[model samples]
Target: MVGSENEARITAAEFRGGAGTAAWRVTATGPQAVFRAVSLTQAASLVGPAVEAAERLGILADIDVRPEGVIVCVPDRDFGGISAAAIAFSASVSTAAASLGLEPDPARIQSVGIYVAQHSATDARPFFAAALGYEDLGDGDAVDPLRRGPQLAFNPITGDVPRRGRTHFDVSVPADQAEARVAAALAAGGRLADDSHAPAWWSLASPDNHGVDIAAWSDDVGD
Candidate 1:
């Protein structure tokens, strides 16, 4: 088994540089891949290979199989980021998908997280963590131990009142897809809230004023 100390410091660049990682995108949480499957049965077929690969590497992976496709992720809390073993597991899964004629869709891979506006993150962390059944990661962030839910991050409120809703969603996608995603959201009736961070992230509001931030800064792993 790969020790946590050895796997914890691996970076996005390192993972991308490894063989057969074109299908995966490295987010802040870890490396994720989306495989295109036509049905739930087809998606489930990939789970065995994914789990076997992780087992071979003595690592844990989250596999979510849906009717449309399957999402796989490797998140390590010990290192608080991507791990070296993740690269091997991802490569093995990619090989298995290829053998089964399933193609990986990088554009379809994304991570969703929630942001809460708090007057004092320290004071509010415990309540939210308990409510969500999450483990406080101690940096204004809380995560689902099961890796089945979106992560939550606490952002400081600048004024006595929140300018918008107390909570917003942040979707992180591959850097190349951020522009098109932003455009699509706007076309869908969402209004641009902030773009000063364009190419990195963009803040948008739904017709109902719910906020969403399209981010790509963390997924900029280069070849």
Candidate 2:
């Protein structure tokens, strides 16, 4: 539910990751920022409970369920769509843990994924924009028809990345709230790595040091 057909400018695609991994990222102002599913089956498992819990939290403002994953909507600019989605997934995981009669932190990282591309963001943007019917925002940005909401920020890379590149989470988590989110991620088995020295952007490792980034809001966007 990114938005009503009229209110949204959204588009998404499964990008190349590692050898056997792939993920989907979208452009919109909602919780459906990025979804990492190793496969179609896994996507269903991860997204179902997330969607359910998000709805229950009344935080689920929008959604667009896809076979690969889903795009959920949130409320504001300051809200962390990626983090909210993670929490929703955690809630779903917690519910599953309860159903199994086991005591476990649903917030724990059950799986990790890194969205990448076979080509650089420079090349991927035009390709994906055309493939998904989106408009290229340049500088590694692309959006759906409406040109708003969840968005994909392609990180250009040199050398070899796992499976070239795959999709993962990219959102503007505030600098103040970032440490808390990082702490929570660590508590849940995620490792921290600073990909950027800039005060706002950060890189996180999924215990395995995958290349997913949680960025800070910057004024340089689209410049």
Poorest 10 consecutive residues by lDDT, candidate 2: 13-22
RMSD of 1: 2.7
Off by over 4 Å in 1: 1-3, 6-8, 162-165, 218-223
Best by lDDT: 1
lDDT of each: 0.81, 0.44
Residues 99-187, candidate 2, lDDT per residue (tens digit)? Answer: 53333221211112123354442466666667778765545566665534356567666664545655666545533345566677778
Runs of candidate 2 with Cα error greater than 4 angstroms are 1-122, 147-149, 159-163, 195-198, 218-223
